[model samples]
Target: MRNAPLGALETAAALRRGEIDVRELAADSLDAARGVGAEVGAFAHVLEELTREQARTAAEGIEDARRGGTLDELGQRSPLWGVPMPIKDLTQVAGQPFEAGSMALRGNIATVTDGVAQRLLDAGTLTVGKTSTPEFGMPCYTEPATGAPARTPWDLRRTAGGSSGGAAAAVASGVVPIAHGSDGGGSVRIPAACCGIVGIKPSRGVVSPGPYSTEGMGLATDGVLSRSVRDAAVGLDLIAGPRDGDFMPRPRPPMSYLDSVGRAPGPLRIGVLLEPLAAKTDVHPAALRGVERAIELLHGLGHVTTPIPAPFTPQEWAAFMPLWSVGAASIPLEAQQEGELLELTRWLREQGQGYSGVDLAQALSGVQAIARRTGEAFSAYDVVLTPTLSGPPAFPGELQLPGGADDFGAQCAFTPWTSSWNMIGNAAMSVPLHREEIDGTELPFGIQLGGTRPGEEALLLALAAQLEELDPWPLVREPSAA
Candidate 1:
């Protein structure tokens, strides 16, 4: 009961030692979540009584396991025992209201649980609530018409990059230590960079997105937004693996993700990418400073770093937009709800609807071609490091509507490097390694490190954890202190 907001490992050990009651821990988490959450607009729903009930159930089960002499097995099965985990509104949770940050289906309830979400519960995670996201998760910004915009703790007026914006905001603001996030075209990593947290997008199939989902353009996959690499690894372990009828399935990782963090990745070759595919803007000085520091740190740790060429052509990059747009229109939005969509969503959907089946197929094939090309180049290097975004968090509505033009091309300029990992189905992480004062304000910036292949996920985690140890960022920010 004494630990107010312990880290993932500390929380589990505390729960095992009976030093803290699950209900109290959950209550504390909910209080913090709602307290900072109110101003940040992080949650769409706070499953209050449901969270308490879940904590009570897990607490009783811990005692039951102790009496039955199966405590060690329980520990092995549930390493994050009774810790709080917030569900991103992008995923479905059975019986929970889920509209995905839209007014169209505001009262719709999830009839079946998403596979990634179920695995979290089975691992004894105390589910706290749901984080807000963009409508149908089409945009990288997180201001939804149904609720308030999800804002950065560093500057409330700045954007909390999305579609996992609320998840990043809550985790970054010390509301919860870790929260579920999804990365499709940099949704997870983008927000993390904005808020100064770790966001890892696993290999496409490593985490399932099933049981009623259109997230399978092989783009969006569930992950975690956390303060530390180890916390993200704990989340990956709990959620990784295949479901019974998965869209994209891969073999289990060679080792538990949690175990990989403490193990060193060893010396390796690293590539630095400055110009991202299709991006026209020059790299922001703040962003370059963060990744430059990362390169220096890696050099100090005995790794080689050098410049790398951009892998995709302008034509290949152009095709991805239509392919992703086709996926957006593929979703079965009820005819009645059609009028409720944002102008940007409706316009994108219309563009997708105009494409012939052959056109859509060609677009998907083009995307795959680009992915293959990128993957081949990645094999030569252990890791490719880049700035997670072109710049620090932009002002909240700068790229959003209400007088804003919905030019995705312009938005993509801000986050050109991140989505390519999604296209290639590689594991990537945003490490908060740099902070600097600009225009009389100091904000955090992230450096990205991505794996060449699925098996390289462990190496990526180990490397990120090593960086955190060598030059750690503030784990979390409390709004009260701000």
Candidate 2:
């Protein structure tokens, strides 16, 4: 079977040239999922029958388009036509299992397709399966009570960070060329960093959260995880746009994100911050080394680098937690079903329940104020750089054990720098750049580049593309001789 050894765009080109067929691509992806994906528990459900049906339909459509002499136009409209990508379990696909990694929602099937899923489908990409996530996407690690833990392919003992952990694992392990993910407080970037892949969390409203917007707080948005920056850019182009019911729809960029990749983002002013902002944990030496290496690379690329203090404050973090708890509390669950929630999720829900409407209003206002101030402070530079996580990948159960407040704290400490961009609605990306050997296993470390202004994703993509060219990351994990 011809697997996804090529990037998403390359795979699409091959499909258009008749070098590969949709059925062959789907079969390869499915085969990989049943192998490495099963080994790492990357999926909550593998839609084998659904994938086969979709592949058949897609192949027929491609043939019809070719015969009608509209193939080029169709390819232009759907850049990823005939490619295979998986949606995260947090998203609902009509007629598919929609278990968001919780025993409470076991056997629950979605009756509608979310806006993000619809956009991906409209782009001509088939959904091979639903990737695993934490319960209600609450934690930074994916150890759901309902299924196997999503472990990093680099080391099966280490966690593939969540709540987009499985998405990262799938892409990094060559199950698919790219996958859909969502970011709320570093969900996408954290897992991408852990698994040694690229993750792009676009600015708020870039991708619609329609039909049933989660939490309605605007902290989370759909994103893309892939092995290369260009692939992530193409994935973003496929799904990014304002839907009719979107509350905050940003204008589309003049140039598509794919067009922005590799373009010269003229020597940008880059601010580097090595300190942890939201969490109290100290940055690990390995993480620091990653940042230092990134700084050297940026300097070599002619970008001006300056040391900057953590732009966020403890007061901002204090304000942000209540808002997060409010989201957790808002999750629909019956009293009996609440017991099915993980300890950390339950604790967060309880914390949310404690806040009055007035308290929520106050918290929202505080967050908005902090966002404005933080944005103003960041205006001095084009992009801010930091380590994606405070440390390397955590072993399974390392962060969740001793659950409750401790679990939340452990997650925050691990992903110390990624949430600030989410708070301010700016674009952020995790680019794998460094590796370190720990306990006889070599693990990847990612450095983050966050755009200073909202809707500046093009700039970040350009910079990431340059970095990718300079130090290309492996498209898939090296095969093990087990």
Per residue, candidate 1 scores C-alpha lDDT tens digits across 1-482 of 02235677777878888898888888988897788887787898888987998999899988998789887787888988788889998788889989888889788898988888898988889889999898878788898867888988887778889989999989888788888998888999999998889999998888867656644578778888888898899888998887668766877778799998999876989989888676677788989989889988898888899899998765568877777788878878889988998877887888888899899788889888888888888778999999999888888555765522345766788888888888888889888899887666677798999888765678999999889999988877654212
Clashing pairs in 2: none
TM-score of each: 0.95, 0.97
Q: Model 1 scores what on Cα lDDT?
A: 0.83
| Superposition error at 264 for model 2 (Å) | 1.1
Extract clashing residue pairs from model 1. 1-20
Model 2 Cα lDDT, one tens digit per residue, 1-482: 12338889888888888899899889988888888898888999999988988899889888998899987887788888889899999999999999899999999999999988998887778799999998989889998777888988888888999999989989888888899999999999999999999999999989888866742877999999999998999999988888776789987898999999968886899999887888878888999999898888788899999998876765567788888999999988888998888788889999999999999999889888888887887889999999999988997566986858878888888988888878888999999998898878888899999989989889999999988888777668843311
Against the reference, the lDDT scores of all candidates come to: 0.83, 0.88
Each candidate: how many clashes?
Answer: 1, 0
Residue 11 Cα positional deviation in candidate 2, in Å, after optimal superposition: 0.6
Best by TM-score: 2
